[model samples]
Target chain A: MAEIHLDGVAHSYLPNPTDERDWALKPMDHVWRDGDAYALLGPSGCGKTTLLNVISGLISPSHGRVRFNGHDVTTTRTEHRNIAQVFQFPVIYDTMTVYDNLAFPLRNRGIDEATVKVRVHEVAEMLDLVVHLGKRAIGLPADAKQKISLGRGLVRSDVAAILFDEPLTVIDPHLKWQLRRKLKEIHERYRLTLIYVTHDQNEALTFADRVVVMYEGAVLQVGTPQELFETPSHRFVGYFIGSPGMNFLPCRLTASGAEVAGQAIPLGGTVLAQAAGASVLEIGVRPESIRLADGGAGLTVQVRDVEDLGARKIVTCRLGDHELKVKVSAGQAVPAERATIQFNPHLTWLYADGRLVR
Target chain B: MDKWQNNRAWFMVLPVFVVVAISAIIPLMTVVNYSVQDIFGPGQSVFVGTEWFKEVLTDRRLHEALWRQFLFSGLVLLIEIPLGVMIGLAMPKKGWTASLTLVLLALPLLIPWNVIGTIWIIFTRPDIGLFGATINTLGIRFDHTASPLDAWVTVMLMEVWHWTPLVALLAYAGLRAIPEAYFQAARIDGASAWAVFRYIQLPKMRGVLTIAVLLRFMDSFLIYAEPFVLTGGGPGNSTTFLSIHLVKIAVGQFDLGPAAAFSIIYFLIVLLFSWLFYQALLRVGTGEKR
Candidate 1:
C-alpha cells in the first residue's frame, strides 16, 4: 500500500570509508511505485540485497533518507515499517504447524483469532498448502517450507510490501516456473508492491514489469523488458540482457560513414552527426539484429561457425581481431567458409565509454 | 596379491578387543559376577541366586537415598538448563569479549571434583569462611556441618556452580549454529523478544539442550566426590544420595555383594530416566492428525 522512495541512499559497512571502493551501495535515488511488480536484477556482489534491505528497513542507510509516500522513515524499525521480507532460504518456526506459521504475523499484530484463522486458511489455499496446514513446518520439504515463509507475509493485510530475496533458489527446477507463476497471480489478485531480487535474467525479465539492472554496486538502467531489449541505455545492459548479448566493434565515426574494424559501413548523415566528436566510439549490434549475406553485400567477414538452436541459428563470424555473432532466421542460407555481416541500421548503436549514445 | 588370502585382518582386531575388555567389559562382568554371589575369599564364593538383589531392593536406607537422589537430580536439571540457556543468550556473539567471557565461564568447570568440594568447605565453613562470617556478622547462626538444610543447600550450590558451565557451553554452540536469517524473519514478522525465544531460539536449541539435560542428569545422579567431601552424608544422613549410600555400604561395611547389586540397580535407574528424558524432549513437535 506504500510507494517507497530511496533518496540518495548508500551504505558502507566500514565506520570510516575513505574511498568509493569501501561503499557496498553507491548513492542513488529511486522510487518503487505501489502495486508494481519490480525486479532488482544483478549478478552476485552487485548490492541488490543491500538495496532490498534498505527498503525493508533492516539496515539504516549510511547516507540519504528513505520515505514512504513522501514521509521520511529513515530511522524506522523493520516491524514498524509495515513491510515483510522472505530470505533466500526458508525461515519457519520449527515448532509451529503450517497454519500457525502462516498466522504468526497477524497474531503478532494482535489480530483476533477468528480473523487470523480466516486469513491463514485463505493464504494456505492460495499457496496450495491447505493439505499441510496441520503438519509441523520444520520437517516439510523445502518448497513447502518456503511457501510458509511467504504465506506469513501474505496473511498480513496491512503490510505495505512483501520483498522476496531469491525465494525460488532452493526450489526444484521444474517447480520454479510453477511457483513464479503463482507469485505473479498473487500479485495480480492482491496488487501488493512486490520487489523481487534475483541474478537470473529470465526470472527478472518474466516476473517484473520493470527490471532494475545493476552492476558493480551501481544501478545501470531501469526499464521494461522490451525497452531493455530494444534500447539498452548502457552498454553493459546491452551485453547482459540478451542470450548471445550484443556484439561490439571498435569503429571510427566520419562525416559520411563509419569505419568498423578496418571495414567501412555507410550511415545516415544524421546518425554520423550525432556521434561525430566522440573520443572513444564503438558500434553495438544485437545478435538478432545482424544478418548474414552470402555474396558479401555489406561488411566482409570470415565465418567461424554456425550453431543451430531449434527454430533459429547463431552465426559466429570474425572481423579482424573482433568476434561477432549474428542470429539468422531459419530460411537464410549461410556460406560454409565466408559470409558478410550487415547490421540492421536501425538496431545498430554507438557507445562512448560504456554508455549508450541516445 | 592373490598368493594367499589369510585372515590377518582378524588378528588386527584382537588387540582392540583385548583393550576394550580390560578397560570396560572385564570390570563390568566382575560387578555382575559379585552381584549374584556371596564371596568369602579369592576363588571361594557361593552362588547366591537373586538373594542380594532382593535384599538391596527392599532396604529402607536405600529407599530414602533413592528418593534423595531423584530430588537432587530433578533440582539440578530444573535449575541448570534454563540458567545455562539464559547465559548462552546473554553471551556476546563475536569479537574478543566473546572469547574472554567463554574462558571465564569454563574456569569453574576446570577445577578438579574433590578440589571443588574442598573449596566449598573453605567457602561455607561457619567460623572462618567469608560466606559463613558474612552470615554470622548478619546475626544469623548458619553452619553447613551442623544443619541438614544448610548442608543440602551448600551441596546443591557446589554442584550447580561446577557443572552449569557445561550446559551453557553446549547451549552457546547451538545458538551460534542458527543462521541469522531466522532472526531477521522473526523481526519482520513483528515477533517480540519472548516470542522469538519461544518459537525460534528455543526450537533451534533443542538438539543441544537434549544433550545438556542428559549429561547433567546422569552426572548429577552419579555424583560422589563434591557432596561426599563437603557434607560426608552428614547431619543425620540428610544428604546421603544414592552413590554416597552405596559407598557407605560397599566400603564402610565391606558388603561387596549387596553393594554390587545396588550399583547395577542404580545404573539401570539412570539409563531408564535418561532414555525417557531423551524421548520426551525429541517428541515435542513431531506430527499431527491428518
Candidate 2:
C-alpha cells in the first residue's frame, strides 16, 4: 500500500477561473497515510468528490500534483494508478453473473482463471455474497448489487487503495449499519487504505479514524472523532459536527477579561492572548457544556423552547439578541419563564473571526 | 359488491374499428376475393378455388423474383447495419458538430421514395449523369440500362445510400442514451476499446439495432420504386424484385387473380420474418438463459 498525497491541488471546470467561486476545489495539500481509514466529510458541492476523483486519477487537478508513495501520478490513467473506486450508485455489469462481476478486474489484468476464481470466491465470502455467486447481477436487489460492486474492488489485492464515494447512499436504512461494519472488518483484516466520502456526520465519525471536514472548497479541520467534537479548529466545523452544534455569542476581549452582553466573563490568559487580534470575537460552547444554574448568577437566559429527548432535554434560550441551546439531563429542573446558565470554563472556546483561538 | 359491466364500452371502440375496416380490411378482402375468382367483366366472374394460387406458386418468374428479393434485402442488411453503426459511432457526441451531423444524416430519409428513384435515375444516366459519366470517362464500360450486373450494383448502391441514414440515426440515438457512468466504470475495469464496444455499447444499442434491422428488412424486401425507375427491370428482368413483379402482373398484364394471390404470400413472408427477427433479437438483447 502507498500513501496518497495531494500537493497544492485545485480544480476548475472552467478554462480560466477568475474568481474563487469558479474553482471547484481551492488549492490545498492533503496526505492520506498508508493503510489508514479516512473520511472526507462535506456537504454537497463542497469538492469532496472532486478531491476523490483527483486521488483516483479519474480527473487531473488543474493546479498541482497527486503523488502516490512520493511518485507523481497526476497524469496517470485510472487503471495504471492501481486504485479501485466504488461509485455513489452501485455499478455492476448487468450481463454478467455475480462471480463474473467480481472476476472482471482480475481478468482484465490477465490473471489466470484459477487465481481469479479463488480471489472471487474469497471476496464473495467476505462480502457475504457466496450464495449469489451463480446468480445474475441484474436480477439481484439493490443491496446485493452494491455488495457485488464492493466485491469487485475488494477482490483485487494489488490495488493501492479502495475509495468509496457514498456507496451506501442507495442501501436500505436497516442494512447500512451492517454493510458499514462489514467494510470496517474488511479494512482491518486486509489492512487496505480506505478513503470514504460522505456528507453524513454519523457515517464519517464512525467509519474513519480521522475525519477531514470541508466547507466551501477548502479543508476546515482534520481530526479524530473526539477531537472534532471537543476542539473544532474552525467555526464551521464546530457548527457542523454536533447535533445541536456549538453556540456562538458576540463578545469583546479586554485587557482584564472578556465581556459578553455587557457582563464580564472569566477567560484564561492564553485564550485572551489568542483573541488579541482586532476583529470579530465570539465565545463558542457546546449545548452539553452549558449547565442550568440558580437565578441572578452567571448569565441569565429567557427560555424559549424545551424539547425532551429521552435522557436529556435541549433547552433553547435567548440571551439578549443571541440564541443559545443548553442541554440538560432529565434530573435537572427547567424553569418556565427564565433560567440562569453557566458555561463550563474548560469546555468553552474563543474565536477571533471564524478560526478557533488556541 | 357487484361490479358494473359497461356494455357501452363496445360502442366507444366502434369508430376505430370502422376506420380500420374501411382503410385496411375492405381492400384486403377485395384482394382475397380476386385471388379466388376469375373475373370476365364487372358482373361476370367464375369462382376458382385455389387455382390462381397454384398457378402463381408454380410460375418460374415468381421464383426468380422471390430469390432476387431475398438476395437484395440480405445484401442491404449486411452492408448497412455495420456501416451505419460505424457512422453513428464516429459522429461527434456534443456541440455544433453533433447537430450538423444529425441534420445531414436526416436529409436522405425525408425525401419521398419516388423522388429518390427519380434523383437516382438522372444521377446514374450513362450519357450525362455525374456518376455514370465519370465511371465511363475512367474507361470502364458501365451502363446500368444495358448490363445486368451494373443494374444490380446501381440499385443496391441507391438503396444503401437512401436508407443507411435511418440506421445511423437510430444507432446514434441509442449511443447517446447510454449513461456516462458506464464508460467510466469500463475504464476503471481496464477494458479495451473492443471490449467496451462488445460488452457495453453493442448491448446498449440492441433495441435500436432491432428496429433498424426489421425496418431495413421489410423496406428492402418490398423495394420497387428506386430500382423500377433506375433500371425499369431492364437487362432481361435481373432486378425484378417481388413488389416490382407484382406491379407488373397487376398493372402491366392486368393478371389480377395471380397478383392478388402473390400479394397475400408476400404479406405472410414479411409478417413471419418480422416476428422471427423480433424474437431472436429480444432473446439476444436480454441474454435470457432459456
Candidate 3:
C-alpha cells in the first residue's frame, strides 16, 4: 500500500485547456492515504473515471503532479506503476481455463508452476470461484466473469494498488451487493490501497473508507460517507449524493433570516453567517433533515407526488414554485395532496453561486 | 421490436439468395454433369461412371499440377498472413494517417486480376521491362523466360504483391474491433508488449485470420491468369498449378471431356478445403472453454 497525492492535476484531450470547459479533469489538489479504500463517485461523464485513470497512470495530467509513496508518478506507465485494474467489463482471456486466467500475471512474471497453482487456487477460493476453476471462462455467466475480473486484480499481492472502474456494473443486482461486501472484507483483510470508481452513491458509500464526490471535471468533496451526507461543500454534491437528493430552493439572505418565495424563515445566528450571497443564493436541505412541521415557523408547501421505496416514503412537494423532496420514515403516514408541509430551517444549508457561502 | 410479417424483410434478402443461386448453383450443376459423362460433340454424350475421377487420380500430370498448387498456396499463406498482420499492427490508431493507409492498401485490390498479371509480365521481361533492365544492369543472370526457378519466383512475388493488402485490410479491421479498455487493463497488469499481443491481440484476431487464410488459400489455389501471363506455365511445368493444367487441356488442347472432369475435381477440392477451414475455425473460436 502507498499514499497517493495529487497536486493541482489538470488534463485535457485537446492540447490547450484554456478554459474550465476544455478540461476533462479540472485543476484540483487531493490526497489518499496509504492502505485507504477510496471511491471516486459521481454521475457518468463527471470526470470520476478520468481521475481514477489518472491515478492508475493510464493518463497523464496536463499540469501538476501525482505522487505515489512520495515519488512522482504523473508520467509513469501503468505497468511501471505496479497497479492492477479491473475494467467495467471483464478482460479475462476467454480461451484460457479459469485457473489459467487467474494464473496469467504470475506466469508472465515467471513464477514457478506449483506456486502459480497454489496462488490461483487461493484467489479462486477467496472469490468463491474454486469449484469451477478447471472450466473455461467463455461459458461463464456475466457475474461469474466479473468475479474472475475482480479475482485477477486481487490475486497479485505485490501490486501497490488495485483500481476498479465500475467493476460491479455488469454484475446482477444481488451479486453486486455480494461483491461489494466481499471487496470490503478483502480490503480489511489485506489492507491494500483500493480505489474504486462508480457513479452509484450506494456502492461507493458501502465499499469505501472515504468517498470522493466529483462533478463537472472537479472533485467536489472528499470525506467519510456521513460527512458528505451531513455537510456537502458544494451544492452539486448535496444534490448528487442522496437517493431523492438534497433539495435546493432559491432564496434571499438578510440580517435576521433568509426569504424563500417572500416568506421569512428565522435563522439561527450561525446559519445566517453562512448565508451570505455571491450569486444565486439558495437554501438546501436533505430529505431526512426536513419534516412536516406542527405549528412552529415554517414555509408552506403543496404536495406534488409521493414515492414508496419500501422502508422510507419520498414526498415530492412544492415550496412556492420550486420542487423539493422530503423523506418520511416507514412508520409515518404521508400527507395528502396540497398539504401545507413545513421544514426545520436549522438543518438548511445556505449556498451562494453553487458553493457554501462561508 | 417490430413484427416479422413485413414484406420489406423478404425484399432485402431475396436479391442476395437469387444472385448466389444463379451464379453458384447453375455452374455447380454443369460441373457435376460434365464430371460424370464423356462428350464427343455439343449434343452427343455418354455417361461414364467415375471414369474421369479414376483417370484424374491416376494421372501423373494431374498429380504434378496438384502438388504445385499446394506448394504455391502454402507459400502464399505463410508469407501473406504474418506480413499482413504486422503491417496492420504498425498502422496508426487514429487520424488522417489511418484513412491514408486504408486508401493506399485498397489500391491493389481495385486492380483487376488479369491486369495485375499483365503489368507484372511486362515489368519482369528481360529486355523491355524496368525491373528486368535494372537487374540485368546489376549483372545478375535473372532470365525468367527459360529458367524454371526464376519463373516460379516471379509468379510467387507477383501473387504476394497483389494479395497481401487484402490480408492486411482484414487484419486491420480485426485489430480495430478491440476496445481501448482491454489495452488499459493489460497496461495496468504490467503485461509486456509481446505478452499483450500473444494473449490479447492474437486471440481476438482469430476470426479475421480464419477468413483471411481461407480467402487467400482459395485465391492462390485457383490462380491461373497471372502465372499464365507472367510465366506461360514456365520454362517447364514448374509454375503449372491445377487450374492452369485444366485450362491447357480445355482451351489449348481442346479436350472438353477430360477438361470438364478435371474442372469438376478442381472445384470439389476448393469446396472441401474451405469446409475444412471453416470447421477448424469454429472449433477454435466457439469451443474456447469458460
Candidate 4:
C-alpha cells in the first residue's frame, strides 16, 4: 500500500483547453494517506470519476505530477502502476468461471498456480462467492457479477490501491448495505488504501473516513463526515451533505450584528468582523438547528408548508423573499400561519462570499 | 375459455399462407414431382417410384462431386474465418482511417457474383493477366485451364478474395459493439495482449462469428455462378462441385429426373450441416451452465 499524492493536478479532455469550461478537472493538490478509506463525492459531471481515473493511472493529468509514496508516477501506465479499479458496470470475463475471474489478475502477473488458487478461494470466500466459484460469471445476476468484479480487485495482493467508481450502482438497495459493510470489513482486514468515487452523500458519509466534496470540476471541501456536517468549509458542502440541505438567507453585516431583512440576528463579534468587508453576505443554518421559539422574540416567519416525517417534521417557511426550512419534533405544535424561529447560537454559521466565516 | 371463437383470424393469415405456398411449397412440390417421375416431355411423364433416386444415389460421379464440394467449403471456412477476424482486429477503431478501411474492405462484397468470376478470369489469364503472368515469369508454369491443381488453387483464391471481407466486416462490427469498460478492466487486470483477445475479444465476437460462419457455409455450398463461369467443370471434371455437376445433369444433358433426385439430397445435406452448426454455436454459450 502507498499514499497517493496529486500535486497541482489538472485534466482536460480537449486538446487545447483555453477556457475554464474545457477542463474536466481543475487544478488542485490533494493527498490520500495510506490505508485510509476516502470518498470523492460530488454530483454527476463534477470530475469525481475523472479524479478517480487520474488516481488509477487510467488517464494522465494534463498539468501535474502524481506521486506514490514520494515516487513520481505521472507517466506510468495503468498496468505497471499496480492499481486495481472497479468500474460502474460489472466487467467480468464471460467465458471464465468465477474462480478464474478472480484468479485472472494474479495469473496475468505469473503467480504460481497453488498461490493463485489459494488467493482466488480466499477472495471468493470474502466476497461470499464461494458457492459460485464453478459457475460461469456471465450467468450470474448483476449483484453477483459485481461481487466477482470486486473479488478480482481483492485477489491481487500487491496492488497499491483499490479504486471503486460507483461499484454499487447496479446492486439492489437492500444488498447495497450488506456489500458496503463487506467492503468496510475487507478494508480493515487488508489495510489497503481504498478510494471510492460516488455521487451519493450517504454512501460517502458512512463508508469514508474523510470525504472530498467537489463542485463544477473543483474540490470544494475535504473533511470528516461529522466535521463536514457541523462546519462545512464551503457553501456547496453545506448544501450537499445534509437532508433538505443548509438554508442561506441574504443578510448585511453591521457594527452591532448581522441583519437579515432589517431584523438583527445574533452572531459572535469575530464572525461579524470577518463578514464586515465582504461584498456578499449570508447566514447558513441547518434545518435541525432551527427551532420554533415559544416567545415572540426571534425572526418572524410565515409558515408555507409542513411535511410530517414521522419522528420529526420539516417546516418550510417564508421570511419576506427568503425561504427557510426548520425541523420541529413530532411533539411540538406547528403554527398554522406564522411562527418565530430561533437559530441555535453554536450551530448557526455566517458566510461571506460563500466561504464560511470562522 | 369459450368453446367457439371468431374465424376471421384465419383470413388475416391467408395472405401469408398464399405467399408461402407460391414462393416455397409450390416449387418444392414441383421438384418432388420431377424427382419421382420419368419425364419424357412436359405433359408426358410416368411415375417411377424412387428409381431415379436409387440411380442418382449410386452414381460414382455424384459421390465424387459431393466430396469435392465438401473439401472446397471446408477449405473456404478454415481460411476465411481466422483471416477475417485478424483483419478486423487489426483495423483502426475510430476516425477517418476507420471509415476509409471499412469502405475499402466492403468493395469486394458489392461486386456481383458473375462479375467477380469474370474479373478473376481475366485477372488470372497466363498471357495477359497480372497475377498469372507474374507467377509464370517467376518460373512457375501456372495454367488454371489445364492443370487441376492450378484450377483448384484459383477457385479457392477467388472464393477467399470475394467473401473474406464479409466475415471481416461482421467481425469488425462485433468488435466495435464491445464497450470500452471491458478493455479498461482488462488493462487494470494486467492482462497480456493475447490474453485480452482470448478472454474478452473472442468470447464477445461469438455471436457475429456464428452468423459469419453460417452465411459463408450456405453461400459457399450453393456456389454456382463463380466457379461455373471460371472453370465450366473443366480440367476433366477435376474441379466439378455438386451444383456444377447437378447443373450439367439437369440442364446440360437434360436428365431432369436424376438431377431433381440429387437436388433433394443436396438440400437435405445443407440443412443438416446448418442445423449442426447452429447447435454447436448455441452450445458454446449455454453448455457451461451444466
- Where is model 4 more than 4 Å wrong at Cα? A269-279, A293-295, B2-15, B285-290
Winner by TM-score between candidate 2 and candidate 1: 1
lDDT tens readout by residue for model 1, B1-290:
74355576768899999999999899988899999999888889999979999999999999999999999999999999999999999999999999998999999988999999999999888888888788878998888989998998899889889988899999999999999899899989999999999998898999999999999999999999999899999988999999999999999998999999998999899999999999888887555322
On residues A81-139, what C-alpha lDDT tens digit does candidate 3 reach at each position? 87788889888786788898898877777789988888898899999999889888888
The DockQ of each candidate is 0.74, 0.52, 0.55, 0.71
Q: List the residue pairs that clash in candidate 2.
A: none
> What CAPRI class is candidate 2?
medium
Off by over 4 Å in 2: A255-259, A262-265, A276-279, A293-296, A308-312, A328-334, B5-30, B39-49
Provide the overall lDDT of each model, using Cα atoms, as 2-decimal numbers: 0.90, 0.90, 0.85, 0.91
Ordered by TM-score, highest first, the candidates read: 4, 1, 3, 2
TM-score per model (chain B): 0.93, 0.96, 0.89, 0.96
Candidate 1 C-alpha error for residue B151, in Å: 1.2
The alpha-carbon RMSD over the true interface for every model, in angstroms, is 1.0, 1.4, 1.8, 1.3
What lDDT score goes with residue B3 in model 4?
Answer: 30
lDDT by residue (tens digit), candidate 3, B207-255: 9999999999998999988888878787889888898899888889877
The C-alpha TM-scores of every prediction are: 0.94, 0.92, 0.93, 0.96
User: Candidate 4 on A44-87: residue-level lDDT in tens?
Assistant: 99999989999888899999999999999999999888898999
Off by over 4 Å in 3: A268-277, A293-297, A330-338, B1-21, B285-290
Better by TM-score, candidate 4 or 1: 4
Report the lDDT of model 2 for residue B16.
Answer: 100
Model 2 agreement with the true structure over A91-112: per-residue lDDT tens digits: 8887788998899989989999
